[model samples]
Target chain A: MSNRGPADTPPSEYEDEGRERLSYVVGLVLALLLTTGAFAVVWLDLLSGGAALAALGLLALVQAVVHLRYFLHIDLARSHRDDLLLILFTVLILLIMVSGTIWILYDQHIRMMA
Target chain B: MTLRGIVGLLAAAVPGTASAGSFLEPAGPIASAQFSHFGVISALMLIVIVPMFVALPIVLYRYRRGGKGTYRPDWEFNWGLEVVIWGIPVALALALGMALWKHTLEYDPYRALGPEPLVVEVVALDWKFLFLYPEQGVATINLLALPEDRPVTLRLTSGTVMQSFIIPRLAGQIYAMAGMQTQLNLLASETGDFIGRNTQYNGLGFATQSFTTRVMSPDAFAGWAEATKAQPAALDAAGFAKLLSPSVVSEPVLYGRFTPGLFGQVMARFAPAMVQGHGQAGMAAPPAPHQGHHHMPEAGR
Candidate 1:
């Protein structure tokens, strides 16, 4: 809508600063780096089993943060609280569903007679 | 027929198998515990279903066909009814979940049941069950006999596709997978013959893939084990290959002896081909560990 900001600055100057094109490109490059690093570690056999899994998990967490901060523009500011709250709720529900499914199925897998 | 006669008929009809195909007629310790769990869960589920079944008829009769059962057009929501509707199922689910959690840990498959439980390695082939008693150096087709009162652990794998090993009176089914091992621990409480089979279908012969489990006393078992050593059939690699040729074993087979460590090799035989899919051509597998063990008794061969 209106490209208006602080009275001290003109609208055109403020719009250029707030566009965040540089931040998004940086986020995209970082996400690709994390993904490629994880894949290379596995492909090159740098780590095996649990170590490789943990490394990939760490990289994925960082990439997710990059997406939220740069692409989705989520922040701690009061103006973005509603969107942040929705994301938090979605994550909570997702964690509950995935964990509950794993708990039930893994329990069956371990306890069933073979 | 009289009640006693009917009961007698039912018992005899299922002879050489457990009394029932369901856990209700459990013949072993594991199955008995599972049967109890089934009963508990069933009752908990009825907490939801039974009330609905009873209420449906009463509500229909009272409200329909001009039957007057005190009309309350102004009624909205009753606090007591609301609490009853939601509270009961939630309470039942919590109770059932706790029970499941406790028993699940208690009956974990990998836990060893006793100090010296008999180990039976099972391979589910096309339409038959091949049970190898590694410790005894014996193998059987379509027959699994064990000593009563001793815990038995079955290390199960599949030679072909996946199948489920189930002995209804003994324990619930667990899957048998190729190229991997799974475990089941159970113990017979009393001497009885029970039915065990592959519960998952693979091919045309799947329907008849049943086997018999005879639980004899320790003395009888020792005798049977000794007698098995003289069964005239030696379960060498060639004999085993013949066994793998996809035929239904209509009768029980006994191999007086099996090559030591044969079970491990049988498990390994699937690995390379499964991984490579080269039609087992010139795979050049090294001699199996059991094949090396054969020199212990026969010095010349």
Candidate 2:
């Protein structure tokens, strides 16, 4: 057999290493920006009441996505399909429990008001 | 096969001092419905639990080291066994969820059980419950009186910390919180004395924070109300201030007269604006004649 060594390694692995390091820096910047933006909206009184709430909620969603993509290395790639499906299933279960609780409480509230 | 016999058997099997206060011996429609719901849920859970328990010893003995049981070392997976293991629990859970949802709606505590409900304002203090009959213009400490077959609405609030008000024989527990009001509607099916208590632990006197609930005939209830109104004790601002101090009252105290709008005053202490608006609206609206008597005077500003 011919010599099989580091020379035989694919070029994509080196590119992947660079991209992986870069992804963490990018994720950190995005997370900090989102957090600062949320704090600024409240501290500087940039938004009020429901608008402020909506902005904070949006920033939180984006931050979650950044953490998942960079730290957890979860994405739409075929190799990550199992992890994505697992997260979706967990989310489904959470939504069912939370929404069911809210629905029951709200219905009880309405009946009490009546 | 009688319902009484079944309930009796269940009560005997359960290791508790069964008394008039027992939810297992429900005295009202709501409590009875709750009891049935609990029974159904327990039976549903046992469908899975009982079989696993029964099979444990049998499987252990048969598959022991020197036993003559057939063993398949190469066995990996079987579709039939997988279906049996997963399918039953999923189906049972779905059924249980549907049942719970249906019953929760049907037996909502706030839902009026009958027409002409007697409205009582309940204030849970540090270690006692004060029941004010808004309609009857009387109040009592550590006692609740109701007319059998007639619906009774209790509007509850907590003067100190949060507490849970429950008369297990008559209904389930509903929370009482400071600054907020919760409502419970109940109707007694028969005349009897039940026990009501604050289930939430608040302070040193939590254990003795219980009241007697007397369900009597309509005529008897009216007479009791009239007699209570004739008592010498009056609950004014001074008396109320004394009550605010945490203490366990050994005997039920009856007040011949209470300051009008006392309940509103308690509510206003925490949420002034909301209580003011509510009090004003209630005063402005003309009372429906068909509704039971309401003697609430103008709320203290």
Candidate 2: regions farther than 4 A off? A1-114, B1-4, B10-18, B276-301
Q: Tens digit of lDDT per residue, candidate 1, span B1-301?
A: 2433444356568755344465656778788778777667766798799888999999999988588888888989999999988899789889999999998999877667798999998989999999999777788999999899898999888888899999887887888877656788888877877888898989999999999999999999989988998789988888888877888999999998888766666666765433233222321221112222211111111
CAPRI tier for the interface of model 2 = incorrect
Off by over 4 Å in 1: A1-18, A22-59, A72-114, B1-22, B70-75, B272-301
Per-model TM-score versus the true fold:
0.73, 0.74
Question: How many pairs of residues collide in each model?
Answer: 0, 0
Error of 1 at A52 (Å): 9.0
